[model samples]
Target: MTSNVNIDAHQHYWDPARGDYGWLTPDMPPLYRAFGPGDLAPLRTAAGVQRTVVVQAAPTVEETRYLLDLARGDDSIAGVVGWVPLDSLDAASILDELAREPKFKAVRPMLQDLPDDTWIAHAPREDAIERLIDLDLAFDALIFARHVPSLIEFVERYPNLRVVVDHGAKPPIRDGIDAGWQPWADGIAQLAKLPQKLHCKLSGLATEARKNWTEETLKPYVAHLLEHFGAARLMWGSDWPVLNMNGDYAAWHGAARNLTSHLENAEQDAIFGANARAFYRL
Candidate 1:
């Protein structure tokens, strides 16, 4: 029988009252409200996405617990990439406390929003990074182009920690895919060298492209990822409410399918589900 195990390796939900989502302010009307299971269920069904790994939209242990509570009630939500104060000395203790919930799968520190791109690879966070390996938890790098260099170093140092670069480091689609981004492209290739430890998500592109995006506009970046990371390390994700700001869930999934139509059935399946199941341990 079929079940809700077809994994969308990345997605997110947030209630403004529960966490401090500074980026999700009143200015972004589309993402300024609450997004929950009920809001996403129909879209999931339509796209044949049965399960999802809910990522953190803010940087607080409080929000992580809040998301774990939601997963406790929703089986479709197979796991969570929750948040914790990475720089805090108490990070390991906090992770130990959160591990009480089996659905807690990974930790993301909102690296993209941080002022210093190398914050994750800095000396102060080394203890916490090793603790993740000891606890059998993952490190989800929510980073941007500038942070990819640090990401490479972080993965190399802790070769055992399962590190995933969220949204392919959020490439600048709004600026048009051009030659200026050769370094980002090179960084992706560098991360790819750590095949056994690194993973990437096919998500969050829609919002980055905004009104100027098209299927053709996104193909090159998708191809770039596929060329470096290949199908086995890539996983599909809706990016949900954030996706809603630019386009609907089904539309993004459709766009993803359209972009990768050249791949065989097995490769497509890896991108859509199987790889996620293995990576997230769903």
Candidate 2:
């Protein structure tokens, strides 16, 4: 409804036949359905979102290539943050391959499902992250509350690597739980000292909170990130098909706009799109 240009910082487009999305089950009817760029265009236009950064939902390079190809065919997708085996010995070569495509903006390792204490412990993952930095690629930390400490350590060690905390560290809000989120908030505050190296997406809170979360229910989490990271380092995201777990594209977009209603026009512009554009180099 506002005049500010919007950008969806965190959204996904997937094809089940191409990759394994074991997470999407029949019980999850809304998300188990198909989604594509054509499906997103009307939503984008209705939400006033001029551009989007398509993120990878799968766990393989072939999936990454698929997202890149989608970006190649869709100009509305300003950039793409896909997956790559950061622990692989050929990590640098994979980076080289993706670098050829300007739309390939960053990489994410699905660490949320990994064991609490894995090889990404400290030493090995730190080295791998450094290699990512050497190649000038950004890293998206997709972890839950238990993994926040490791994420903090990684960000501290690789101060130069651009790290965006997806889903506000995926807080357990649906259960009305905030105890586990306090430490995550503390970790984000500490990482915020690195400025551009740290950013956060104001998405996913709706699904995390009550199923039909109104603006009031989702305000606290959004306010926390806005206060901690500020609009300059914060970006708006639809979370798309994942958001379908709670509601549709209109619901998510409406929630986002409602949360930012109190901000100034310029501040809203930064959070809605400008920050994402600058962060992903779109």
Candidate 3:
């Protein structure tokens, strides 16, 4: 918890040649190319980011292994949030296989792409969450605002679950609409009430915003997260590579730093690094 330590708790690196990313289309030039530790190393260094938690982008377990392999060679990567098949009854074995990897701290099932919003609550899925809890693995929720209610319910179902809502649950930033704001805020506040278990990441906000976004336009939404989650539960992440679609790593980190410059240095330390270290045992 030293003041100077900094960790980017969420980021991604993918090579289409290694595993297919169904969502990664050729038109998206920013993401079409492969990214690895070499690309991120200097960006983080310039931004004073000393450690990172690389989360998964592709749904395949092969991709998870790909990332684990990358982590095996990269010391800056403290841990990883890789994917696993939560719908199948064999989830326990898959988790067992994954947990054998020392840096595997969590699982993100890619709920946003699925048709059923409450899929996490159905059948073997709930059992899968219990497995995650039993194995001491965190659950990274890659959801949108619409999934907020079910996400809240899912978390409530497991009091011991450690949850981090990726991308502010993906607010309605593209249209600059406030209609989704209230529900997102309300659900987030409800989740934040689970002080010990629930956490939020300050990331992927710019991409959700309009193509030409500014800190002022994003301040209202970011501030609300800071308000409810507090410094200890709020972690700053570049969401790098994906962040390249909206802005560069340095710009995103600079914006996050500026957004919270009003807070005390210790609180800044938590948002920028300490919280991530404690949350993921990084």
Candidate 4:
């Protein structure tokens, strides 16, 4: 019973009939299956999540349009961080088209597989990120710890872009070791100096820890980012369907509450929803 109105900032919805999630396969049940707003509503209600910011799961503009259409019809979905080909010659035009839709709040490029140091250095993609900045679209940085230095460079290069570090830069929780993250954490600390930066979806720590993670187990990672970014620079995100890979929505929320139990009510409120509302203009 936290009284703060919760906003699940990092959930996703997809339809197999609309497009194929090549990422989904027979090995991954539950998540490998289709999920739409309807599947999410009950979970959110039960977890006391009043609003949500739907994020892109697929790498297609059609997926963005589909999520935007869902957000249009669903008040509970407060905003959407959709996808577009950032390298496309008409990237600005595509972003302009998405901007016309009220719920289209941000965009993300799936950069997890790219090499840590040189991925963003790729000319066309760098230009694309620059375009997003010009358009006032927030970029959700989705990379592993190895990419931290490069991400730091990207942030410095685009000071105007509102960058959200997804999953606390997705620390290595599975191995129960964070020493690998010290350099990454230091890099984030440097990036935090930027006025517009923030972090998201405190939900993945369990998977990263890949142990029987309790609040104590997640404290080092959560507390590290919370300290660096402070409440104003932090936001809550369910990372929903992916969170399903670790546990259900309620379970993730419980873990988050436990980890932040020491914070004052207002601070908790900021991480839970208020920051997301203001960040996305939801």
Best by TM-score: 3
- Residue 45 in model 3: lDDT: 94
TM-scores of the models, in the order given = 0.94, 0.91, 0.95, 0.90
Better of 2 and 3 by lDDT: 3
> Candidate 2: where is the Cα deviation over 4 Å?
1-5, 117-119, 123-128, 177-181, 193-197
What is the Cα-based TM-score of model 2? 0.91
| Tens digits of lDDT, candidate 4, 18-37 | 65466777697767777888
RMSD of each predicted structure: 1.9, 2.7, 1.7, 2.8
Q: Across residues 1-282, which tens digit of lDDT does each residue of candidate 2 receive? A: 223557899999987666477666668767776688999899889887888888888778888898888888888888899887777777777888998898888998788866654434553445556766876778787877677667776677667988888888777777664554566666667766664458888877776776777777777778778888887788888898788778777887887887888899888888888888788877
RMSD of 1: 1.9
1 versus 4: better lDDT goes to: 1
Clashes in each model (backbone N, CA, C under 3 Å)?
0, 1, 0, 3
Worst 10 residues of 3 by lDDT: 119-128
* Native-to-model Cα distance after best TM-score fit, residue 132 in candidate 4, in Å: 2.9
Each candidate's lDDT (Cα)?
A: 0.82, 0.78, 0.85, 0.76
Q: lDDT tens string, model 3, 120-178?
A: 76644666778888889998988877787787777777889888989878887776656
lDDT of 1 by residue, 40-147 (tens): 999899988888899988787888888999999998998899988878889888888998888888888888778887877774367787788887898788877778
